[model samples]
Target: MPLTFTPHPFHPADMPPVTLITDETDDVELARAAHRSANPARGRIAVDPTPATLTSAFLARDILAALGRTAYAPTRAPVITAAPAWRAVACWFIVDGIRELTVLRAHLLTPERAEQLSVLRELTGIRLILLAAPSSATQAARLGTCLAETGLTDGLLRLTADDARAFFTRSLPTTTPLCPTFPLSAAPVSSQPGAARSQYRAGQLAACTWLARHRRATGQVPAQRDLELFLSRLTCLSPDPATTLARIRGAQGGFTAEGLRLSVPHALATAQGPGLSTLPFTARTAHHISRAVPGPPQLAALASLLFTGAHLDRLVQARVDDIDPDGRFLALPQPESAEFDHHNPPPPAWYAVPPSARPFLRAARMFRQLEQVPGHFHLFSKSFGYRLEALVKDAGHLIPALSHLHPGPAWHHQARLTHR
Candidate 1:
């Protein structure tokens, strides 16, 4: 599995074994040796094909092993294959961004496997390099047939030993290393005089704002997922709030520029008024949410409340599929069920999610998805009733003005998680 550089069969209609790359002495190991010089990081992978099983599933798994995806992850897990084997193979080629795929044993391929590879190449636009000499006349005939089935002409650029040597002049190191000194956030990031922040800047400005405030709130570098989720949330927000935008830009500047840590600009410092030490109402609420928000459903509901323009009742009906792919809008009634006509279809209700609040909504969506909740399932039904009192207590503690001290029989303004 760890990149050891190292075959398949045929039917008639087989073209003569198309010459791929051949060494001077006809040694297959020599043919496979070039993989040592291939750079997997740069989207080039040379596979040692495990072609013994001869089934399509086995071929698909062989390709995956070469691409380094024989592992489970939220995005790349292959167990729940979204497509059939050959299609999955093609899909992963795109997902992993592969440009060149080198297979070590060209002579061993079956017509079926050759067809799969050729189809994959067609679908993904990946360059296929077949190596190894057909060790016998039978293998040579079969390989020719395989190549014909592959739908590639014998004209595939044939590199001689000298050319192959020229191509793989050097080997790349096996792994990439990470740098730790990369900026995470800045609570006391040293401020500096620079060109003034442009008022026109938007998304990056929002990112910096979140990072600056996050550092102020937590007093340390964010966890990796937290930073990624924070950026993702900022992507969801509206740009009208210039204060948030400017702060976000400052945070970005820290990462891009050499010396500037993500401190708020003097313009925002003066305009937004006092800093976190003064304990502004929103800041206090942020603290409470950090410490006491019940869970994803409650937190997401509170986040949506800030900018969604929808009431608690509307949000209570939110389903896992409500939000758009970009995480910016939550469409009420769901887009699929919304009316569309020939002339001008009436648009469904578009509820906006501030980029700053998208992470909360995303967390809630993920929570629902993990439980295998269907698209139409309500997000809040399970958690709301039992946790309602605790949430109301927290809400009131954070913002007494908007919250009711006593509860009603059904969910109401007083019972909502608005303060978070």
Candidate 2:
């Protein structure tokens, strides 16, 4: 439903009947003309023609003085709360019985700021939105026309529950991804350059190392979820799980039974090093993995695998059957259920070895291995695909068009480069 405002109740005495003047020579017009004629004393002004002088504060002050006097008024202006920059000039038109003021305010506006103004107008029922922006006169004039056509001052506002759903429904493009990028493999700690020591890079390095070690130990791949948790822990940055998963899917690489692998560009690999690795992973503090990895798609994929594995291991060990469809899965509380405590977690779920879940389990174990051996020469991209398929089998139903979107090496590289 269109949003409407209930006008405040008005006693008959609160509002006076608007006076109408049919003739052009009305008192208001006469008053304005008389005021203008009386103020016709000419003032000579000189200005330096140089570029520096043109932008000088003194010149700006003089210009403001001249403009201000010409547009001066004796009447007190009404106060507007949360007025958008573009609407500052049009406030007079929005307020009933105030159109004769002819007062104009100088301001600037940008396209993004203008959109913000529109959104504010929709959210608030205020008319005569006055803004103070530094936009060009032509741009302001165009915006004024847009305001009028859109009825931004007078029309009912539109509201929606979920902006994302609304956007897709209306065929609006979603925001561009902003995930971080890093090198393909965890670089050696001793070989780190000054720039590589950034908190982000450090986290990526730690995550990569963790994944590589896990892969080597388990002879399997890691899932996207596993990578996500690993990175999150290393960086101490947490992103929405669903959103992170989506970005991982969009990033280049795939999960496999052997390890999480990302296809690194020949250029990047040559420039940085072979098989990037992250931090040394320990089971005791594995929960620290939640930081995001920044890099090309392949790096992003590896990071996702590392971080997500850490998170899933904890979650799975906490309550095994929570995700299992069959009734065979069991929940074992920590410090209470010795069967799945720190010393001994329930043997991998029965389904872990089955055709349906075996691939995912293998990927998970590979991520664990990567954590153990931070230095290893592995086929990064091939590992990524294998892990990706496993994650799809486990959680593909949670996303839209999971089967249709296939991320390429270029896409991964572009995702990393642009994001970084």
Candidate 3:
């Protein structure tokens, strides 16, 4: 079967034009089409309608799976099996950065089920494509009516099998590379504050000794220029502790393996070093935050809480100026009472934003700047209440720490002060 699509078929908007494709083929063709069309990286999801049930919930389940949402944990199962799957599905679409959805076998869906898909489009702003069999004129007409009512009738393009095949083959946002996924796992590399530091110290001594010994034995002392460059590289501070360490280890291995008769010990090469390889945030927390947090502001806030273990009070006190220009460092000042304004405010404590959290922080900062908030205004105070609370409510379902609060403050904040 041949397929085709427009050269420029996508619009970067929430309510972009929708597409409808009609064709008849063997089951094999349908299977092939579904497989080839699904592009999770581009947020392009292709879901074949369920044969047994054509309900919205089933549709949501298919979309969720296509979007790569898995309910591996018993707690996570509710995300897919919830009473109204649409709500969960909608949240995940935004969180996962979904841009388009394609449903196969559109001709078999009932008007009600089709309407539900329409609602999903409105909620998620994903471009929708429906592929159906042209078995009968009556079915085509019925599908047309469904599309019209649901406002699914936008940028309608008619293409043959060659056109469809080309459409799926060409380069589009749908074919773009995907962002790195940070799955939930054990606590970050630094279980204790000193572990990484100690490891780095141990590795540093080994690396220096090995380099000196190799230079003495091989009479391969570095020239002044080369020594300066090597020193600069060896001491540079990397953004991530783990990644930098990996790069250093890899570099050492390459140097030794490159016919240099010189090689650092495996332990030295693999040891944790002061590099951009820090994992302040837990992998599990990072995974849930991306799927559970609704917006960038919440994403940044929840990430801070998860990594810093700080209360909302500190987050609320954050100033737009608290974050660095690169969105890498955040300085959290103490909350000042309305009653007193110090002549000279104390300097705030600074924290490094993990690589995953930095993007959200940068986005949130830009969002505030677009709204033209004064530099001194609270960065998260405006979003601190329910907006942030909802973050916990949804993410809490999957995050063990926040699961008990019913979407409120962290455990420590639950304590109350009794009034007279």
Candidate 4:
């Protein structure tokens, strides 16, 4: 089968046109003058915050309100307001009504980090409503009260549930064309001791042979850099040079081992690191690999992470201690860590994934893949725990059965582990 690649459907190019928020009759000149004075600095100059800064904040809030009304539905947009000196007050109102607000803590407040936190807040708000409704009507009411108290009555920037549903249901053109036919199966690797070595050799040789043929067919000769990289990975995986060469020369496929290696030269080199030398493949290296052979375990794992909103870095770095054993879930702080204190830490609860995610079993399998890799099992376990946490946080209805599925040390250590 020919290789097929599909990119994400949502791209910057696909976004709607920007809507300007200028008004000739309004205080445009005043806002501009204020902005200039507040940010009067070129290359290395210091900029001072003055009345102009406050005016600029007002302008931004106004623009945001307009954008919310035009770009988002009533239930899905944020409640934007031009409160030049009222942001703190608004925040207090939200906190007072909701009884709490999550704040994330980190070492530095970088611009990128701030942006990420803002996005997380928006996502958390939507998720909270979805997950806490019906069974937690009181919580929903408190959320509504908080919004109302925070001067969100304008309703222009805030979104409602109906608006969110509409957005997800909207149709858009596909970015990546689906493959016509997927290569679903391949022969299993031989496990016989003496035969194992020869089998591996044959596989490697087959890959190299296929790579040569593929290069010839595509008329795109493999690069020397790529060949070296492929050879390097092969050597790392198979200490026995003869077997490595044999497998490269023996495989039969549209894309040869050498050609495939050449196609992803950088990846092949990276995958050859001491840590990955013995592994069959690296997670990053398997994307294209699976396209040539659909339904592979690697593909499934990737799919799961993508669809579940799990952060790859977080998953890779997670430790067993992060899991709440009693809850069998991952605990993600809201408003997030900046909003919480470490000395007197807030109670971290577990989040459970809903059963609906079962459809993406392939993606879930990636956790298993991580587990199989030496030194990564703890990280994988933490990721699994987190996935469960997200499920509980996002699930509309709580299923008691899943509560006990994860029996990690955290659960056993807790005195109230069995309380519903």
Candidate 5:
């Protein structure tokens, strides 16, 4: 059933006559004009208070005409409303009663709408009224036409700069004045002279060295999980087991054999040097090795093997002051752990240094001086593993015939025995 609005009381004197203005052909403008000219104070222009029912164009026009007549005569204005969606009637009503219109959400009005409003006022001889809300260029252009000529206010006018300052001063005495601030530019980067090397992080270095040593001793690399377990056995390792395992994985270079993994392309290798069958290396090969041997850690590593044929562990733990200047000897230290006690101990306390190793020892001493390596206690820190690999790399760069001369622990041990 269609919903119908029924009056509560059906008494004659109790209710005012409700005129249902359904006839669109009625000359509403003439009737309103006659009513206005006859007796403006006596006649009341009844507007349908419910805007929802005022959906048709004819209804909007009748309401606007009634409002116009009431506005022109000596009388107070009655409230008449039009919906935003019904464009033709809304445009007509707005242009006609622009000075009297009050809208909600007027900022949502589009440029096309503002343009339409301009065209509407021009064709309908209606004066447009604008409010403070829609202040875009399009809205302003439409408003400028009526406002400039009619000298009408756009609802509320903006305050002058001086007036605004005075108003704030009077209203807020202790409030902080706002000021704009700009950010400073960033610093310039410094330049480096040589070709940039791939950054092998410090964390990965120790794990790589440990893995290489393992592969050398057992002739097989351990699996990733096994490597993690091995690193866990070392003291002063990362407290987080997961982080240590991650570092080991990062150090590995993706080579696997017999379900075990090896991190090749590392700074060092464990390839054995030919013992009695050692051949002379070319000057070019020696030059390449010299250049490839990176920094003091690698230099110290190479020097330990070539000079006194000291073991890797003893070379690492040996102190700077352990070297005798006049005697040309490196004082090897005891093993940090007795786990390797069954293996041969270092040659002696003061192992003789070869003449060929003198230059490298001098270079190591100079590097120590340059770096200001402190404490005559330990020659290299735990981070020494970072450079140990580079020494192996230098040996690897040798010419094919001289390649077998790559210094391994066994070769150094043999050299030490031969010297003695």
Candidate 6:
């Protein structure tokens, strides 16, 4: 799929020629042909083949980086100096709304991050995109609030199926049309409606696979509502499933009566599980975590449980001041706010140091050297639990007793058991 950016608002008189940024090499050729053929006055349109996330900061850095490589003279418009690799065959950049790229308000961008973009914009003269999809009225309101323009909204043209198809064909001459004879299905019936929706793109691939298999077995495409239900359920894993479904439904604008069939790429369409290693935890499993974990942070974090029954978050947030090195004791912090989980409130203010103090001290000493007043430091990274869980899974293969523990539950169970 082509790397698509949200359209920005701009005036024709002030607008610079459109530049397509993509990680796909083939897209470079396609975009070049299309843009040049469409308008010679548009000047030389450059299709950047870089793989950086199209955030304001990253794009600003990329634009500045590209300035050093090309012989092109610097102009008022920003220049890209570095670009990331993309696997896309063809991508596009449109002249419409080309000046200020818009970020979907539904993403719930933090105010701090938005201010950072404002700083970058002042430095680079590149306006950050702040548009939301028109399908969402609430999002539109939120976007207005973010921009301090509550009255502003861009009207979206709802195109007919034929109009969309015509636009698509004219827009990219290089795109090969999916042949009608292809035994492809767009949406699939999910066997596990109750199953937690995986990732967005993952669910789409799975749904497509299910649709293809169903067609092969029953010789009929599923109803539209069925597809909608599958997507609604599948997208529940996302922050806004309703918005996600609306986006998906909006993309289905061109689906014909026969159903919109697509060629599923090999890598993405392949069925895969959560890819976590599985095994139950035993004392031996705990030992594996201790050994497999190669850092003081992880070791110190795990060893803390041996001395005190603190929860994972509490132990990680412990600071140097919380430790009484000479007294052979540790103090867990109280919750800063009353909004603690009812089931797992704050631990006691103090805990006796365990026999594993040698390594804990080593870890603590190392942490102090890094930063003297390291307040509320973490021993293990956010992902450490998953890594430890995976280690337990790998250990299960060799140790028969650990084989019964499923990695998902086993990880949580071990975490809960830390308090005991």
lDDT to native, each model: 0.48, 0.27, 0.53, 0.29, 0.35, 0.33
Task: Return the TM-score for each candidate structure.
Answer: 0.43, 0.18, 0.47, 0.24, 0.25, 0.23
Give the best candidate by lDDT: 3
User: Backbone clashes per model, in order?
Assistant: 18, 100, 23, 52, 2, 18
Query: In model 5, where is the ten-residue run with the lowest total lDDT?
Result: 1-10
Regions more than 4 Å wrong, model 3:
1-16, 71-97, 119-125, 160-162, 171-279, 282-285, 288-305, 311-355, 358-420
Which portions of model 5 miss their true places by more than 4 Å? 1-286, 336-348, 380-383, 394-420
For 126-187, candidate 6 gives per-residue lDDT tens digits of 32333122335574455346433311122322333334234334544333322113234323
Q: Model 3: per-residue lDDT, tens digit, 1-420?
A: 001111111233537676666666524564466567667765677887667885566776666566555322322213334223454455455545777787777788777777777766665677777677767888788888887786567666665555565565552444434445554454544455665564455445544554566568776644423332242244222324453454445444434443332332244322321232122454444655566443445557766665444445666788878887566667666444454369756445445565656656665565455345688987664356655555566566332223212222221122111111
> Judged by TM-score relative to the true structure, which candidate is superior, 1 or 2?
1
Candidate 4 structure quality by residue, lDDT tens digits, 261-340: 21222232222221122222223223332222112122223332332223333334433334332212333221225556
Off by over 4 Å in 1: 1-19, 23-32, 71-83, 160-162, 170-232, 235-420
Candidate 2 ranges with C-alpha deviation above 4 Å: 1-120, 123-194, 197-263, 269-420
RMSD of 4: 22.4
How accurate locally is residue 114 in candidate 5, as Cα lDDT from 0 to 100? 42
Highest TM-score against the true fold, candidate = 3
Tell me the spans in candidate 4 whose CA falls farther than 4 Å from its real position: 1-118, 121-142, 148-197, 217-220, 228-277, 280-420
